[model samples]
Target chain A: MKKIKVFTNGLIKENPVLVLVLGTCPTLAMSVSVINAIAMGLAATAVLICSNAVISLLRKVIPDTVRIPCYIVVIAGFVTLVQMLMEAYLPDLYDMLGVYLALIVVNCIILGRAEMFANKHNVFESALDGLGMGFGFTLALLLMATVREVLGNASFAGMSIGFLQDYKIPILTAPPGGFLVFGCMIALVAYLTRGKAPIKKSFDCEGCPSAAFCRKEGKACGTAETEAK
Target chain B: METYKLLLKIIMTSVLVNNYVLNKFLGICPFLGVSKKIDQASGMGAAVIFVMLLATAATWPIQTYLLEPNGMGYLQTIVFILVIAALVQFVEIVLKKFLPSLHGSLGVYLPLITTNCAVLGVTINNITDGYNFLQSMVSSLGCGLGFLLAMVIFAGVRERMEEADPPKAFKGIPITLVAASIVSMAFYGFGGFVTSLFGE
Candidate 1:
C-alpha cells in the first residue's frame, strides 16, 4: 500500500513536469506532436526505470560524496542504450527526437528522481517510482501535445483534423506557443490542485537539485522577495 | 575569409536564430531561476558561458578523435555528460582556488550547470551540426553569449514585474511564463536574418 503511494504520488500529487517542474526543457521542446510526445515520454520512461533500478541496486555502493556523478553516469548509460535502440528500430522517431533525445541526459526529472527517490528506495520501490514519475511526465506531455498538435498543426498524431486545419494557430507550434501552452497547463494544474501545485516560493538555490551542495544552501539566495526589496 | 565568414554565421545563428534558451528551450531552468536580478543573471550567464565553452572544447575532440574513430558514437550521451560534469567540477575547483572572488559570485551556479541541458545541448549540437573544433568553439561561445543576452534582458523585465500586480493565478511562474512567451515572440523576428544573410 505504501509502495503504491510512492508510485501514484508521481502520477498527480508530485507529477514531475507539472508539479515538481523538473524536466521542462524537453517537456516544452518535444510536445509539438502527439507521436513525438509519446515517443519522448516512453524513451524517458525506459531510461528512468532502468536507471532508477540500477541506482537503487548500487545505492549502497555509490558513496555519498560522488552520488550525483554516479547517478548521472548510470542515467546517461541508459539514455545511450535507449538512443541506440531507437536509432536502430525507429529511425523516424529517432530523427524526430534529435538532440532532445541526447539532452535527456540532463533532464532534471530523471536526475531529480535518482537523487530524491531512487537512491533511497529499494529496487522494487525505485522501479515503481520511476514508472509512476515516467507516466506522469508522459501524461503531462500528452496533454500539452494534444492541445499543441490539435491547435498548432490541426492534427492529433499526424492525422489531419479537417475543420481545425483551416483555423490552425501557427504560433502554437512555435517557441512562444510552447511557453504559453506550458504556462496555461501549469495554471490549470494549479487550479485543479486548489492552488497547491507546489508553486515554488522563489527561484533561489533552494529549489535547485544541487542546492544541498551549494555553499549558501541554507540562506535565501535568489528569491524574488529578497530581490524585489 | 570564407571560413571566418562561416564561423561568424554559426555564431550569429546560435546566438539569435536558434537561441539555446528562447528558441531551442535549452536552459529554461536557469533562465527562469536566475533571472530575478541582473547581477545574478549575469553571474549565472558568465558561469554558463565559461562552462559551455570548456565543455564544448572538451567534448568536440572527444567525439571526433575518440568516439567517432572507435565507433563508440552511441556513447556520446554518457561520455559528454561525464565530461561536462567533470568540467564543471574542475571549473568550480579552479575558481575557488585561483579566483576566489569570481568564485564567490558564480560558484553557486557552477554546480547547477552540470545538469543544465544547455551545456550538454551545445556540445551535442556541435557534433550533430558537424562543426569542426574551431567552429564548435565559436558556436558554443555564441550560444553562451546568447543565453547571457536573454538572461540579462529577462532579468530586467522581471525586476520590473515585481511591482506590477498580476492576478492571483498568474502571480509566480505562470506570469513569468507568459512574459517569456512574449519575449520568445519578439525573438522570432530574428529567425529569418541568418537564412537571408547566408542564402541557406
Candidate 2:
C-alpha cells in the first residue's frame, strides 16, 4: 500500500507533464504519432529509472556541490546505453526519434528526478518514483498523440478511420498541431483537476527543472514577474 | 560564389523554414519561460547563439577525428554532452574572470544553455546532416539565429498577451501555449519559399 502511493503520485496528482511540464521538447516533438510517443516515453522512462536508481545508490558518496555534474554524467551514460540498444534493434524508431533520442541526456525530467527524488530516497523507492513519473509522462504523451493522430491524420495508431478520413484536419499533425493539442490537453487537465492540483503560474513556475538555477542567478523569474504586472 | 549561395540557403532554411523553436521544438522551456520580457529573451537568445556555435565547433571535430576515426561512435552522446557541459562552465568562469561586464549580462544564461536541448540538438544535427566543418558551423549559426528569431518574435507576442484577457482555464501556460500554436502556424508560410529563392 505504501509503495502504491509512491508509484501513483506521478500519474495524476503530480504528473510530470500536465502538472510539472518538465520535458516539453520530447513531449511536443515525438507525440505526432501514438507509436512514436510510446517509443519516446518508454525510452526516456528506461533512462529515468536507471539513472534514478544509480543516483540513489551513490547519493551519499557524491558531494553536494558537484552533484549536478555527477547526475548529468550518470544520466548521459544511461541515455547512450539506451540509444545504442534502440539503434541496434529498433532502427525504425531510432530514425523516427532522430536527435531527440540523444537529446534525452539533457531532458529535465530525468535530471530533475535525480535531483529531487533519487538523491534523497532509497534505491527501491527512487526506482519506483522513476516508474511513476515515467508512466505519467507516457500517459500524457499517449493522450496528446491520440488527439493529434486521430484529428490530424484521421488514423488511430496508423489505422485509418473510413468516415473521418475525408474530414481530417491535416494541420493538427504538423508542428502547430502539436502545440495546439498539447495546449488543449493541458487546459483540459487544468479544468478537470481544478483546485486539486497546485496552481501553475505562466512560464516555469514549478515545472521547470532549471527554475532553481534561474532563481539563483538573480531571479530572472522575479524580474519577469515584475515586468508582467 | 556557388558555395556562398549554398551556405546562404542553409542559413535561410534554418532561420525561417526549419526554425528550431516553432517547427523543431528544441528549446520550448526557455521559449515559454524567459520570453516575457524582450530584453531577457534576447539576452538568452544571444547567449544561446554564442554557445551553439562554440558547441558545434567543439563537437564536430570530436565526432569526425576523435570518434569516427577510432570507431568509437557510440560514445558520441556521452562525450558531446560532457564537452558541452564542461565548455559552458569553462566559458562562464573565463567570462567572469576576464570580462565581468559581459558576464553580468550573459553569464546568467550560460548555465541554462548546458541543459538546453537547442545547444545539444544543433550540435548532433550538424553531424547527422553530414555537414563538413564549415557547413556545420554555418548551420549552428543559422540554428542559433533561428532560435533568437523565434524568441524575439514570441516575446513580442507574449507582451501582447499580457494585455489580453482569456478564459479561466486558459489563463496561464495553456493560453500561452495556444498563442504559441498560432505563432507556429504563421511560421509555416516560410516553407517551400526558401527553395524558390535560390534555384536548385
Candidate 3:
C-alpha cells in the first residue's frame, strides 16, 4: 500500500504540472499538439525514471556538496540517450521536440524529484515516484493539448474535426494561448481543490535547483505573499 | 553600415517579437518566480544576461572548432550543459572573490541560474539558429536584454496586480499566469512593429 501510494502520489494529488507546477516550460511549449505533447512527456519521463533510479542507487556514493551537479550529469546522459534513439527512429517527433528535448536537462521536475524525493528514498520507490510524476506530467499535457488542439485547431491528433473546424479559436494554438489555457487550467484545479491542495511544501523554492545557493531564506522562488502583497 | 542594420534587426526581433520568455516559452520559471520585486527581478535579469552572453561565447567555439571537426555533434547537449554548469560555477567564484559588492547583489541569483532553462536555451538556440559567432553574440545580447525588459515590465504589472483582490483560488500562481497571458497578448502586438521597424 505504501509503495502503491508512492506510485499514485503524482497522479493528481501532487500532479507536477498542475499542482506542483515544476516544468512549466515543457508543459507549455510541447502541449500545443497531442502527439508532440505525449512524445515530450514520455521522453522526459524516460529520463526522469532512469535518473531517479540511478540517483537513488548512488545516493550514498555521491557527496553532499556536489549532488546537484551529479544528478544533472546523470539526467543529461539519459536525455542524450533519448535524443539519439528518437533521432534515429522517430525523426519527425525528434524535429518537433527540438531544443526542448535537450532542455530537459534543466527541467525542474527531474531535478526536483532527485532533490526532494529520490535522494532520500530507495531505488524502487524513487523509480515509482518518477513514473507517477511522469504520468502526471503527461496527463496534464494531454488535458491541455485536448483543450488547445481541439478548440484552437479544431483537430485531434492532426485529424480535423469536421463540425468544429468552423468554430475554432485559432489563438489557442499560439504562444499566448498556451499561457491563457494553462492559467485557466491551474485556476480550475485550484478551485476544484478548494485551495486545500497539498502544495504548500513543494510550492516554495525547493523544487528549483538554484535553491542550492539561494541566500533568500528559502524564498528564492518568490512565494505568493511576496509576489502579490 | 548594412552589417550594422542587420545586427540591429536581430536585436529588435529577439527583444520584441521572439521574446525568450513571452514567445519562445523559455525561462518562464525565473520570469514568473522572480519578478515580484523590481530590484530582485533586475538582479536576476542582470545575472541571466551575463551568463547567457558568457555561455554563448564559450559554447560557439566549442561547437564549431571542437565538436564539428570530431564528428561528435551528437554530444552537443551533454557538452553544452556541462560547459554551462561549470561556467556558472566559475563565474560565481570569481565574482565573489574579485567583486564582493557586485556579488552581493547578483551572486544570490547565480546558483539559481545553472538550471534555469533560458541559459541553455540561448546557447543551443544560437547554434541552431546558424548565426556566425558575432551574430550569435548580438542575438544573445538581445535575448538577455529582452529578458531584462520582460522582467522589469512584469514587476510593475505584478505590483498593480497585488492591489486587486481576486477570488481565493486564483490568488497565487494561477492569477500570475493569467496576468502573464494578458501581457503576452500585448507582446504579440510588437510583432508588426518590429517587422516594420527593420523592414522585415
Candidate 4:
C-alpha cells in the first residue's frame, strides 16, 4: 500500500517533469517528437530501475563522503550499458536522441531517484519508485511533446494529422515555442494543483532527511530539484 | 579547401545561422535562469564557452578512440556524461584554486553546466555531424559564443523590462516568452545574411 503511494506520487504528485520539474534538459531537448519523448523516457526508466535496484541493494556498503560520486559512477555504468544496447538495436532512436541520451547520466531523474529513494529504500520499493517516475516523466513529456509536435509540426506521433485538418504552428516547434509550452504547462499545473500545495520559505536543507517533507515546505522548493546537479 | 568550407559552415551554422540557444533551445535553463544581468550573463557565457569547447574536445577522442575502436560505442551516453561531470568538477577546482575572480563570478553557474544540454548537445552534435576533432573544437567555440551572445542580449533586455510597464499576466515569464519569440524571429534574419555571404 505504501509502495503504491510512492508509485502514484511519481505519476502526478512527484512527477519528474511537471510536478518535481526534475530533468528539464532532456524534457526540452528530446521532446521534439512524441516517439522520441517516449523512447527517451523508457530508456531512462530502464536505467533508473536497474540503477535504483542496484543502489538500494548496495546503499549500506557505499561510503558516506563518496556517496554522490558513487551514485554517479553506478548510474553512468548503467547508462553506458543502455547506450550500447540502443546503438546495436534501436539505432534510429539512438540517432534521434543524440547527445540527450548521453546527457541522461546527469539526468536528475535517475540520480535524484538514486539519492532520494533508492539509497534509502529497499530494492523492491526503489524499483517501483523508478518505474513510476519513469512512466510519469514519459507521460509529462508526451503531454508536452504532443502539443509541441502537433501544434509545432502538425503531426501526432510520426504521422501527419493531414494537410487541411492539420495546421502546424511553426513557432511552437521552435526554441521560443518550447519556452512558451513549458511556461504554459507550469502555469496550468500550478493552477490545477493550487491550494492543495502548502507554501513555505527557505530551501538550504541539503542535509534534510525527507525530500517529500522538505518539498512540502514550499511550492517551488521541490521544483528547484529540476535544477539540482 | 573542402575541410575549410566545412569548418566555415560549422562556425556560421552554430554561431548565427542555427545557434544552440536562441535557435535550438538547447540551454534554456541557464538562458532563462542565469541571465538576469548582462555582466553575469557574460561571465556565464564565457564559462559555458570554455566548458563546451573543452567537453567537445575531450568527448571526441573518447568517442573515436575509446568507444568506437573498442566496440564500446554503447557506452557513449554513460561515458560522455561521466566525462562531462568530471570535467565540470575539474574546471570548478581549477577555477577555485587558480582564478579566484572567475571562480567567484562563475561560482553558481559552474555546477549547472554539468546538466547544460548545450554542452552535451555540442559534444553529440560533433560526432553526429561528422566533425573531426579540429572542426568540433571550432564548432563548440562558435556555439559557445553564440550562446553567450544570446544570453547577454536577452539579459540586457530583461533587465530593462524590469522598469517597463506591462500587464500582470504577461509581465514575468509570459512576456519573457513573447520576447524570446521576437528574438527568435530576429535571429531568422541572420539566416538570410549567412546565405548571402556563403551562397547556398
Candidate 5:
C-alpha cells in the first residue's frame, strides 16, 4: 500500500514540476524537442535516484550545518559520474543534452529532494521518493515536450503523425513558444486539479505513529497542507 | 584593426542579431521579473551586466587552468555554479562592507543572480565558443548591454501597456509574453542587417 502510494504520488498527486513548481529552469529551457526533453529527464532521474539512495544511507554521518554543501558534493559526484559514463557510452544523447547535463547539479530538484527528504529518510523510503519524484519530473518534461514538439515540429516522438507534421505553428519551435505552451499546460493542470478532492499526500504522517519512518518518504509530507485545506 | 573588427562583431552580434534576451532567451527571468518598472529594469540590467562581466573574467581562468587539464571537464556545471554562487556571495559581502550605497541598490538582485541562467550561460558560452579571455570579456559585455537594451525597451512598452485595456486572460504575464513575441520578431530584422554589415 505504501509503495503504490509513493509511485502514484509522483505520477499525478505530488508531481515535482507541476505541483511543487521546482526545477522550472531546466524544464523551460531544454524541452525544445522530444529527444532533448527525454535525455534531460532521464539524466536528472538517474542522478536523483542514486544521490537520494546514497544520502539516505549516509544520513546519520553528515552534519546538519554542512548538509546542503554535502548533498551538493554527492550530487556533483554522481553528476560527474553520469556525465562521463554518458559521454563514453551514450555519446549521441551526450551531445544532445550537452551542457544541460552538467547543469543538472544545480537543478534544484535533486538538491531539493536531498535536503527535504533523502537526508532524513531511510534507504528504502528515500529510494522510493527519488523514483517517484524523478518520474514526476520526467512526466512533466514529456508533457511539455509533447506540446512543444507536436505544435512546433508537427510530430510526436519523432514520427510525423497526422496533419500535425505540416501543421507546424513555427512559433512553437522557437523560444517564446516554449514558454507559452508550458504556461498553458500548467494553467490547465492547476485549474483541473486545484479544487478536486486533493490526493492525501504522505508527509501528513507527522505526529502519527510512523512519523519517524515516513519522514524519510518526503512525498507524503508536501500534500499535507492541501489535505488539511 | 583586427581587434576593432572583433569588437565590432561582438557588439553587433550580441545586440540585435543574436540578442541574449529575444534571440537566445538567456536572462528572461529578470527580463520578466523586473521589467515592469523602467528604473528597476535598468537597475537589474546594469547589475546583470556587471556580474556577467566579472563572472566571465573569473570563470575563464578557472576553466582553462582547472577543468580542461585535469580531465574534470564533466565537473564544469557543478564547478561553475559553485564559483558563481560563491562570487555572488563575496560581492554581496564586499558591497555591504565597502560600497554600502551600491549594495543597497543592488542587494535585492544579488541573490537572484545566483540562479540567473544567463550568468552560467555566458560562462558556458565562453567554453563552447572557444573564446579566449579578452573575447569572452567582450562577448559578456555585449550580452549584458543587450540584456539592458531589451529590458529598457520592454519596460517602455510595458509602461504604455498599463494604460491600454487588455483581455482578462492575457492581462498580466500573457500579454507581456505576446509583447516579447513581437519584440522577438522585431529583433529578426537585425539579423540580416548585422550579417550584411559583418559580411559573415
Candidate 6:
C-alpha cells in the first residue's frame, strides 16, 4: 500500500547516497572495508530510525523557528548513545570508525530526513521512512565497499581472496579510489534509472535540504523550473 | 625556531597533503554542489573559511578544558555541533544586521555550513591531533584555505566540463565525481612532501 511505498522508496527510487547524494562524507570515508561499511550503515540506520520516531512525536511540540536545532540535538543524542554502546561492546569497530562515529552528528541524511519527512509525518510513517532511507544508505555503502574491498584489497568482508590478492589496485583503497568507485556507481545508477538519478544540475539547491532556508533564489537558474515542476 | 618549523609543516600538510575535501572527503557536499562557477565557488569557499576558523577556535578550548577534564569526551559530537549551529546562527544575524551586502551574497551558504562535515571535522581533528591552541588555529586556517583552493580549482574544471560532452548517464554528477577522482589523484602527489620536508 502507500505505507509500503514510503518504506521502499529509499531502497532504490530515492536512494539517499546515490540519487540524493546526501551524506557522501561518511559514505566515502567508511566504505573502505565491507565490515566497516556494514557497521557504519547499521549504526546510522539505528540513529535514523530512533531520531525519526522521536522527532515525529515531538514535531508539534518543537516550534518551527527552532526545529532544525531541536532535530540536531535529538539526532546527536542517539548518535552518542550508539557511540557509547559500540565503544563498550564493539571496541574494534569503534576504533575503526574513529572520528566518523562522532561525525555522524553532522551527517545530512539524518537531519535531512528529520526536516523533510519526520517533522511532518506520524511516528509510524516517520519510522518507516527512516528505516527505508537508512537501508538505502547502507545498501549504497555496501555496494561501494564491496567494489572497493574486492579490488583495492582483494578481499571479501575481511577474508583475502587467493589470486586477487596478488593483483590488488592500491589506489582503490585510497581517497581517489573512493571517489572513482562512488562516481561509477552514480553513473550506473543513472543508467539504470534512465537518467533520472537526480544528478547535479546547474541549480542544485532545488533538491537541497537547505533550499527552503536559502535566500539567494535568483542566482540558481533551475530553481524556477524546479518550482514549476 | 623549531616550533615555527613545526607550525609551517602543519600548515603545509593540512593544505595539500591532508586536504579535507580531496583527501579526507569532508565537505564534498558543497565541493560538488557549489563549484559550477568560479565566483560562486569562491563565495562558498570564503564562507567555509570564515565559519571553519570560528568553529575550530571555539571548539578547541571547549574540548581541551571542558570535555576532556570532565571525562565527557563522548559528548564531543553533540557539543561541537551545537557550537557550530549557534555560531552560524550568530554570524548570520550579525551579517544581516550590520553587513547586509556581504550577507546577501553569503547568507544562503551559512545555513549549509552548519551541517558541513568539514567544519565539524576540523574541530574534531584539532582535538584528536592533540594540537595546542596556536597549532589548532594554524591548522584550521590552513584547512580552510586548502578547501578554498580545491573549490576554486574544481570550479574552473567544472566550467570547462560544461562544454565537453560525455555519455548521457555520466553527464552531470557522475562525470563531475570522476573528474574529482582525477583531482584527488593529482593531490596524492603531495602526500609524501610533508614528511620529506621534515626529513622524518
> Which prediction has the highest DockQ against the true structure?
2
Q: Write the number of the candidate with greater TM-score, choosing between 2 and 4.
A: 2
Ranking by DockQ: 2, 1, 6, 3, 4, 5
Q: Model 2, residue B175: displacement in angstroms? A: 0.5
* CAPRI category for model 1: medium
Interface root mean square deviation per prediction: 3.3, 3.0, 4.1, 6.8, 10.2, 4.6
Superposed model 1: Cα runs more than 4 Å off: A204-207, A215-229
The lowest-lDDT stretch of 10 consecutive residues in candidate 3 chain B is B191-200
Per-residue C-alpha lDDT of model 2 across residues A74-129, encoded as one tens digit per residue: 99899999999999999999999999999899888888888889999999999999
Model 1 clash pairs are: none
Model 6, range A47-151, lDDT digits (tens) per residue?
A: 999999999999999998777778889999999999999999999999999889888878888888888899889999999999999999999999999999999
Candidate 2: stretches off by over 4 Å: A205-207, A211-229
Write one digit per residue (lDDT tens) for candidate 3, span B1-200: 98999899889988999999998999998898888778778888998999999999999999999999999998898899889989998998998899987777777678778888998999899899899999999999999999999999999999899899988777788788888888888898887787777675
lDDT by residue (tens digit), candidate 1, B22-76: 9999999989987887988888898899999899889999999999999998888
Off by over 4 Å in 5: A58-60, A194-229, B25-31, B34-36, B152-193
lDDT of 4 by residue, A1-229 (tens): 8989989988888777765656766777777789998999999999888999999999999986567667878887887788788989999998888777777776767877887789889999999999999999999889989999988888888888887245568877766677678657765665666635321111122222223222443533233333322
Model 4's A-chain: what TM-score? 0.85
Give the number of the best model, judged by TM-score. Answer: 2
What's the DockQ for every one of the candidates? Answer: 0.57, 0.59, 0.54, 0.31, 0.14, 0.57
Off by over 4 Å in 4: A162-166, A198-229, B1-5, B65-67, B161-182, B188-196
lDDT scores for all predictions? 0.86, 0.88, 0.88, 0.75, 0.74, 0.87
Using TM-score as the measure, name the better of candidate 3 and candidate 5: 3
Classified by CAPRI criteria, candidate 4 counts as acceptable
* RMSD, every candidate, angstroms: 2.3, 2.1, 2.7, 5.3, 7.6, 3.2
CAPRI tier of model 2: medium
Q: After superposition, how far is residue A52 of candidate 4 from its true place, in Å?
A: 2.0
